[model samples]
Structures are given as structure tokens and as C-alpha cells.
Target: MNLSPALQQAIKEISSSQGISPEQFIVQTLTEKIGKLKQSNQTSVSQTGLKERDGILVFETESLNGIDFNELIAQSRQERDLEQMGL
Candidate 1:
């Protein structure tokens, strides 16, 4: 879509060095990014302590041990505030 001139120049130089057209390079990069995102999503789902029972998704109680709910909430709020402030 409308890439800046600097980005286009960088892509042109990189693709030329790798002996490929800029369009092919962009396609390859995008494909790799999509593959990584898909793989990450799949792994995250499996790693989460969640399971389906009686048509409902529930977290395993044992997996909740030692978690500091207050600390987590505080950290989440801090992060949200920082994000809102564009830090």
C-alpha cells in the first residue's frame, strides 16, 4: 500500500542483494510472518491451562496456584496507562 520512500529504497536494496525482485521478497517476508503468527497462536492455545467441558471452556484450578491476582491487576493497569500515554 503506500510505503514511504525510505522503506521502498531499503526493500529494493535488500532484494537486489538477495537476487530477487522486490515483489517476490515482499511476498516471501509476508508468508513467513503469517506462518509464524499461525504457529504462535496454535502453541498458545495448547499451552493455556484451559479445557472444554459440558460445552464450556474452563481453566484448570491447579494451574492458578501461586498467582498474585492483585499484582497482576496492578501491572495490567500500569501497562494500560503507559499504552494510553503512548510511552
Candidate 2:
């Protein structure tokens, strides 16, 4: 909560110019910042195709298109087995 001297001066000047107390100005600034952060978080979650289901985080499978996840997993397992066998 410790602000630099220049920041305090700037806040005092700006608050005075806006006819509000520095405390009120700080509160307003923090509220706006919090709002923006929440909005940004929501936007990022949606863009990343993430969702909360039964208190667990899951990805929206619609983003996977026509890729066969089961086949991919099988292929990965096969490759791992081959590598383990030095094949």
C-alpha cells in the first residue's frame, strides 16, 4: 500500500482536479482495474475453450474438430511401447 512520492503527488493533483479525495480516486481506480481483470479472465477462459464441470476444469471438445483423440492416444502409447522395446 506504500506509494512512491511521485505517484502520491500525481494522485493528489489528479484527484484535486477531479474534485474528489485521493482515497476516493484510488478506490475508483481499483474498482475499475478489478472489473477489467475479471472481464479479461472470462474472455481468456472462453477463448481457450475451458469450462467448469462438476467443480472440475475441462476443455470444450468442440475445439478438437474431427481429430480422433482415442486414435491419437493409441498411437502415442504404441510409440512409447516401441521406444521402450528399443524398436
Candidate 3:
């Protein structure tokens, strides 16, 4: 990565003090930092959106499929027959 000599020295010092290799130290620290950054972004995004709702799918058919006009008139008159008979 062409790090500065002083920064490289400092990283070596820290790595030795922590009992870890320099490569391991860099990889572990960067992975943790990246994880925290991703979690922070996800939290903000989730807070902004509304809760979701469920949807229902429905299908329907007409009760009287395709009766003709004369058939409909006859049916209507037959329904009135009982009431008219009482009078």
C-alpha cells in the first residue's frame, strides 16, 4: 500500500504490542470498521421507511351468468306471482 515509513513503524509497534501479525491486525481492524459502517447505514435506511401491508387477491363471477331479456322479464313476473296471489 506504500504506507509512510513512520506509519509503517507505528503499525508494527502496535501489532507487536497486541501479539498479532501486521497483516492480521490490518485485516481484522478494517473488517470491524466496515461492519460498523454497514450496520449504521442499514439502521438509518430502515428507520426512514414505513411498515409494509399485506394484499389480498380476489376473483368473482356473476350469480345469473347470461339470462336473456325475455327470460329476465319472465323470472321477475314469476317472483311477483306469490305476492299478487295473496291480494
Candidate 4:
């Protein structure tokens, strides 16, 4: 393929400095980046059931049944309001 003189000079310089052909250097760089990307994209599944749900899920720090849940619900509502406001 046709390459600019500056690019050709750069390839020669890199190849000589690294003791490898320009094509091999390029191939190695592409290979390494691809491997790293693939590794990073691999999401390891957790053995814990933190994400498992049978149906509609609700999250609450404490049940809203007695006086203990009053403050918890208030705090949760405040947090929800803050989230809605993009805080």
C-alpha cells in the first residue's frame, strides 16, 4: 500500500529501534489492545444471589410496619427526591 514518506520513515525508525518489522509491531500492538478489550468486556458472573429476583423487586432498609420504619421511609423518600433532581 502507498504510504507517505514521513510515515515510511517513522515505520523504519520504530522497526530499527524495536528490532522488529513494522508490520509485526503493528500486529503485536493490535493484538494486545484486542486482548485487553476482550478481557475488560468479560463480566464475571457472581455466585451470590444479589441480582436474582423472582418478580417485581422492592428495596427497603427496614419494613414500614412500626415506629422503626418511619425514619427509614423518610430518609428513603428524601434520597429518591434527590435522585429525581439529578443530585
Candidate 5:
């Protein structure tokens, strides 16, 4: 793969700032992007019962294992607020 000179420079700068080699940075970035793509494709938007209601996105999956998403979000919000308050 060929990268533009400016992009190469930007990658070098970012990788150096992050204390990693340019190749390592590229590999890590590509790995993260591929993982997200795989995860997004794994969910069937049409047949998986995905919906948006009241600004919240909901989806049906067997992985939930009977957990309540609303309660989980509430707990996460509480934890985030506590962390913000330096708890």
C-alpha cells in the first residue's frame, strides 16, 4: 500500500508521540478498524430486531443473557458520574 508523503509524515509524528513505531501504529489502527467492521457486520440490522426509540438504540441478541440494558446504562452513568467527581 502506498501512502502520501504528508500522510506518512503525519503517521510518523503521531507514532513518535505515542512512543510506537510507524508500522506498529498502522497495524494497531488497521486491527482496530477491522475489528469494528467485523462486529458491525456480525449484527443483522434488518432481521436482528434493531430499533431506535426515544434516542436510544436497541438491538436483540442472544448474548444479553437476560441482562437489562436500561439498568446497565444507569449503572454505567452512575459510575461515570462518580469518576467525574473523583470518587
Candidate 6:
């Protein structure tokens, strides 16, 4: 395959500096990239049962009932003033 002159020069420089041939460097790099692609494809978000809605991913898990954020914040403020929390 034909490569750009700049890319060829860069590959030659890096390979020579690392004491490896250009062909070896290219093969190792391509092998690493292909391995990463295969690994990513094997563990996709679809496999994890996460649904995408309006560009946000939602995961189904145990219900989160009786969780009140406002009450938690108010309790935290009271604790901070009374106990000097997190000091």
C-alpha cells in the first residue's frame, strides 16, 4: 500500500530509533489496533443492557425508592453547623 511521504518518513524515523524494521513496526501497530477493535466489539453497551435515549444512556437496576435529595441536603446543613462536619 502506498503511504504518504510524511508518514513514511515518520515511520522510518521511529522504527529506526526503536531498533525495529518499518514492516515490524507497522505489523505490531496494526495488530494492537485490531485487537482493541475486537475487544471493544465483544463488550458493547448493547451487551450490557443499557438503553440510549436522547443521547443519554440509561441502565436498569434495582428500584431507588424513598430517596429524598432535598431532605438529605437539609440534614447535611444541620450537621455541618452543629458538629463542624468533615473537619
**Number of the predicted model whose lDDT against the real structure is largest:** 2
Against the true structure, candidate 5 reaches a TM-score of 0.51
Better of 4 and 5 by lDDT: 5
Candidate 2: C-alpha lDDT: 0.94
**Residue-wise C-alpha lDDT for candidate 2, range 1-87, written one tens digit per residue:** 899999999999999999999999999999999999999988999889897789988888645678999999999999999999999
User: Where does candidate 6 stray beyond 4 Å?
Assistant: 45-87
* Superior candidate under lDDT, 3 versus 4: 3
State the lDDT of candidate 5 residue by residue for 1-87, as single tens digits.
Answer: 799999999999999999999999999999999999877865655467876679877875668678999999999999999999999
Q: Model 6 misses residue 60 by how many Å? A: 16
Using all chains and alpha carbons, the TM-scores for the candidates as numbered come to 0.57, 0.67, 0.53, 0.39, 0.51, 0.52
List where candidate 3 sits over 4 angstroms from the true fold.
50-87
Pairing residues by index, what is the TM-score of model 2?
A: 0.67
Write candidate 4's Cα lDDT for 1-87 as tens digits.
697999888888988799999888778877999998866544322222223257633333455466667788899999999999999
lDDT of 3 by residue, 24-68 (tens): 888988999999998887676567653334653233335655769
What ordering of candidates by lDDT runs from best to worst?
A: 2, 1, 5, 6, 3, 4
The TM-score measured for candidate 1 stands at: 0.57
lDDT accuracy of residue 71 in candidate 2: 98
lDDT for each candidate structure = 0.90, 0.94, 0.79, 0.72, 0.88, 0.87
Candidate 6 TM-score over all chains jointly: 0.52
Error of 1 at 41 (Å): 1.0
Task: Give the TM-score comparing model 4 with the true structure, all chains together.
Answer: 0.39
lDDT of 1 by residue, 1-87 (tens): 799999999999999999999999999999999999988875776689666679887776676678999999999999999999999
